[model samples]
Target: MKSLQLLLGLSRGQHGVSQSLAIDGVWGATSSNALASFRQGMGIAEQGLLAPADVTLDALRAGLPDGVPAALLWAVMINGSAARIEAFHQPLLAALERYGIDTPLRIAHFLAQVAHESGCLRYTEEIANGQAYEGRKDLGNLQPGDGVRFKGRGLIQLTGRANYRAYGQHCQRDFEADDPAQVSHEPALAVDVAGWFWWRNGLNEWADQDDLRQVTRRINGGYNGLDDRAFYLARARWLLRG
Candidate 1:
């Protein structure tokens, strides 16, 4: 984590980096002063410490939250580049701009959701088998006449036969339920589904309220629960404010 932070800091220049090595621990006076200086430069309230309320830089660049340094996005993207983070990022911003995601909180929500879904593009199903990229599973057929299997695909791990079908129906597109052979696969489709879910289910309201639980449930379904919800919310907030 320190290595990551250091590298990110170097990339973002001194102003772009936070002086605190650990976000979880209490800070010494020196660290506090440094953080305060950082906040002052960014025009954030100088709390003299890292707090959940601290502004994130990414949020500022995307016109998200105020007082967040712009360097944070460069840091995350630099750290998580191998997976083509930009692929999701570029499209997401464009989509948000086109589809009424104008607020800082809204952009933060989607970016954070992407972070939770695939660790900010650090992992994609394609890293496994390209065929596994579409949310299929190899259920191991019992006989010749039995059905074939598939594995989860894309970011957010869109899983199950039913989910694929439902996604297709909702999006009004014929999403193939087979394997990775489809670059016609349109993996970006998964994000579209996510955006739709956010819009239709009122998840967009969670951002304004800062209600992590409600937001997680809407995006990640039953699995996020309390712990993961907190984790994601914090990450999202930090990323946006970075």
Candidate 2:
């Protein structure tokens, strides 16, 4: 109990006098606040005591997606912390579901691909400054700086001007025509954009068939990180279906 509290950053050590004054295994107010706060955070009742199942320690420790215990999301983001994971868990699920990634298999596949592409959501835009894509006519970079201007954004890195314009039209809103940087600025939009890309590209069918190579090719436009995508797919499959 003490270890858990400490790990969760609910510590009384800052108050040297109060820290040492424990009436037993408990530290009075510190213990009370920590326990209560954790309970609420996990969506459990505010009651002081809860059974193991009710509290969902296993589900949480396993990093289960909220409301859908049957589906487990990958928590091992390369650059994601516990706070980061918790913040986007429910919202990610919602966006995925809204974009036709409703099945456990589809959901897991979507999460894995996004995780790999965004480097676990730590990066929403490409890191290479769009220099390599300069003058790439196929990407609709006709202008001098269209490459940097239309650089990839969102979890799936929606690169290329043509792609942005098309996706925006598909959603019946102006992203590329109006503001191409909105996805970079808004976190929620970044998530939804990724879901939209998946839904639009028909990747769900490949996920259903467990054809990871095809899914990777579609998302990445080639076999850039086939092994890593495969690894994430396997992990997501276990977490969601196992």
Candidate 3:
């Protein structure tokens, strides 16, 4: 029943219609009306049955574009700028494909984290000054200004001098030595760093198991802003699922 509601919601979203069902596992007038509307839109005969046929469900799933759609990205990042959405769209898709975040579940998890960490794609760098990290050897903030120099950047907020050096090495760019700020400045690099972190942490395995808590812990090093993360996760799942 929830699956039906999700499909209906997806159909509505794809058509630029903002109406959405609650996706609860209960049959009600709203669900009936949504189903009827969907059938009408698809040029199918409307039926009074609460449960739709397998063929109808298959039809609904058919032709869903591979990877996340821009409409869905806008939906998930509700407060995000349209220009930013346009800017990140192709870069995000490329990163997803390159990192093998191709499955619906993986995409959901990845987008949810990105949405939260980036504040719906608004922030590329951490807002706070990096003074607290001045002597944090764990992050390899080994120099006098290492903390302020490599605080956090990129979509997933990659932090620390060590991390910058390592990711720079991976990309063959001197992020640490030359300019660490480029991680957030370059759209493709901003998204790619997140993909690299995802792959490095083996997050796909946890996403495959649908373990949101574990994924959050891995990404955040704890459960900060956990509810917001879950909210985005639910939204991404609804938007991405067939």
Candidate 4:
């Protein structure tokens, strides 16, 4: 299948294979050799055939390019949906690149916070009703329904009318006035907003310092879910290590 071939091709360098396998969805000798090489590297039996239920597919999914592997994401967020993982793959990568989360430490810290905030990319918008934030002048919910209209959305849960307006202004998208829900509806926007928040708050500096507590404080304004955030941070660091 094309998926297997693509994984194998992406993994060639890591597995000590030089030949490129055509990702044409064909089962051929070249593909077989590549798979065998990958299997040998993984300490698995060098079976030429690609089995439907083989663990090799999972291993190959973690191969290279090394931003945030889907396999590692799945591992860290054990309850994450595979469909969501697949959908947010490219968007998350792009957001990280755009926001200068280029190193393993930065990516790990960023992902740890977002993972804790978004429940491992499961819920983009906050589950609770926005009534609690009603009439909260600090959050710029001055109007009758500004709270519900601009409830927290995105991976980092961009909340409040002021925050939305700020992000909309930066991106030239009027999310505060029109289409506020689009932040949660679009994967790219959801992830990008997190990147925007990270960049604006200079959390990457704290991340670079390896100060998990400061990073949490910067994003969360407190130590809420500090334990869970630390758990994800450790997992990401281990998985993202080169």
Tens-digit lDDT track of model 2 for 1-242 = 43233323322332121233222344467656655555555566646543655543443344433334311332334335445566567768678768878776887678778878987777788887887778888988887877887889998988878778877776676865678888777777788889888888898899889788898999888889888777777666655553
Maximum-TM-score candidate:
3
Model 2, position 128: C-alpha lDDT score: 78
TM-score of 3: 0.77
Query: Which ranking of candidates, highest lDDT first?
Result: 4, 3, 2, 1
lDDT agreement of model 4 with the native: 0.82
Estimate the TM-score for candidate 1. Answer: 0.53
* Greater-lDDT candidate between 2 and 3: 3
For model 3, the run of ten residues with the poorest summed lDDT: 49-58
- Cα lDDT tens digits for candidate 1, 58-98: 32334333422333443433335533544565555555654
Our model 4 lands, by Cα RMSD against the true structure, at: 6.6
Backbone collisions counted per model: 19, 0, 0, 0
Q: Estimate the TM-score of every prediction.
A: 0.53, 0.67, 0.77, 0.75
Q: Counting only residues 3 or more apart in sequence or on different chains, how many pairs clash (N, Cα, C under 3 Å) in candidate 1?
A: 19
Model 3 agreement with the true structure over 157-242: per-residue lDDT tens digits: 88899999899888899976688888889899999999999999999999999998999999999999889988988877766772
- lDDT of candidate 3 vs native? 0.82
Ranked candidates (TM-score, high to low): 3, 4, 2, 1
lDDT of 4 by residue, 1-242 (tens): 65566566667678766668764667888887888888888887637566766777557656645656665566556556678888888898898899999999998899889889999899889998888888989989898988888899999989889989999999999985588999999999999999999999998899999999999998888999999999898877766772
